[model samples]
Structures are given as C-alpha cells and as structure tokens.
Target: MTGLFADDSEQIDRRTSRWIRDAVGERLQQCLRPESRLPTHLEQLMSELKKRDPEDDSH
Candidate 1:
C-alpha cells in the first residue's frame, strides 16, 4: 500500500534546512555588526546576476 506520505524524506530535509538556516543566521548576525558597502561595479554585476539568476526574497 502507498503510504500517506509518499516521500517522508522531503519533509525531513525541509525541517532540517530551516533549523540550520535559523541557527546559522542568529549566530552570524550576532557575530557581525552592521557593515554595508557596495562595489563600484555593483550595477553592472547586478544586471548580469539578475539575467543569470532567479531572485528570492530570503535576505
């Protein structure tokens, strides 16, 4: 018989990913204070990156 969760590994992977992300983010933010600056070629690089990548609202 087919199980209720055809793929339990997927759920476990997602939960693990979220936990790792949250833990890393909290520690990194605490270690690094606010430091913001952009490169001179940022605009050109950004255009290229956008063309080559799909954006995600993670940060």
Candidate 2:
C-alpha cells in the first residue's frame, strides 16, 4: 500500500512548480520592457549562465 506521505509529496511538488511558474511569468513581464532591452537582458543572462559552465550550450 502507498504511504500517505507519497501523495502529500506529490501535491507539494505540484504546488511548488505552479507557484514558481507563475512567479517567473510575473517577474519576466516586469523585467522585459522597452522591447529593445530584450536582447541585452538575454545576453546578460546568457553570459551569467556561461560563467557557471563554459560548455552549457543548452541554455
């Protein structure tokens, strides 16, 4: 039989993901503005990501 904790963990995971997705959408909407600044923001993000791992091309 499955334990009660399994269902609770699954529910928690779903809730956490939904919250994160919504938060990201809201934050991105606020950050991505003026239309022209999109490229610069993207480049900055990419540069930061590359610094973490030089071979990370999946970004």
Candidate 3:
C-alpha cells in the first residue's frame, strides 16, 4: 500500500494526466468512423484501432 500507488501517482497525474483522458475520448470517436463520415483531421484516429488487439476491443 506504499509503493506505486502511494508515490508517483500525483506527479504523473499532474504532468501527463491529460494524455490518458484525451486518448480515451479520441479512441471513442475512432470507433464511430465506420458509421459516420469523419472529418479529414480524424483520418488517423479512424485507423488508430488497428494498432490495438482485436480481441481486447473496448469501447
């Protein structure tokens, strides 16, 4: 109870916390590419899922 959780969490959360949340939101929009016409800027996002495991799919 006094390792990674007790230490580093706060520092990491403050520094790169936005990255995780942004990735989650961006990934969600990527999943909808097949059903909707995505904007040009989203081209990479639409294809991002290919990098993840097909069996581990999560929305």
Candidate 4:
C-alpha cells in the first residue's frame, strides 16, 4: 500500500538525517579540540586582513 511505502520512506529519511547529524557532530568535536590549528593559507589571509586599512572603521 502507498501508506506502507510512505512510512518506510519516512523512517529511512529519519535514520539518514540522524546519521548525518551524528557524523557532523563527531567532526565538529574533533575540530574543537585544543590540537586543531588554522590552515597556513587562512592564517596568512587573516594576518593580511589585520593590517591597517584606511577605509576600515573598526580600528
């Protein structure tokens, strides 16, 4: 029946969503650990951005 198929589809969607949430949570936890460091390129970019800019107001 269509109802049975819909129920199965909903269950599958829920399981998939839960799995994705768990995976992302684990990855975020890993990233939040003390040992994590910003990538070199991003660090360089941030350093450049921190330099004085005449047009910037938040100095």
Instruction: Estimate the TM-score for candidate 1.
Output: 0.37
lDDT ranking of the models:
2, 3, 4, 1
Candidate 1 stretches with Cα past 4 Å from truth are 1-12, 36-59
Question: Using TM-score as the measure, what is the rank order of every candidate, best first?
Answer: 1, 2, 4, 3
Candidate maximizing TM-score:
1
List where candidate 3 sits over 4 angstroms from the true fold.
1-11, 33-59
Question: Judged by lDDT relative to the true structure, which candidate is superior, 1 or 2?
Answer: 2
Candidate number with greatest lDDT: 2
lDDT of 2 by residue, 1-59 (tens): 97777666445454465466458757877877756444677768746645655444455
lDDT of each: 0.57, 0.59, 0.58, 0.57
lDDT by residue (tens digit), candidate 4, 1-59: 35656655445454465466458647766877668766788667645644633333444
For candidate 3, lDDT tens digit of each residue in 1-59? 46766765457542254456458767867887667866777657645643442432454
Which of candidates 1 and 2 is the stronger one according to TM-score?
1
Model 1 C-alpha lDDT per residue in residues 1-59, reported as the tens digit of each score:
98888977756454565566558656756776668434558547645644543332453
What would the TM-scores of all predictions be? 0.37, 0.36, 0.33, 0.36
**How much does each candidate deviate from the true structure in C-alpha RMSD?**
10.4, 10.1, 10.1, 14.5
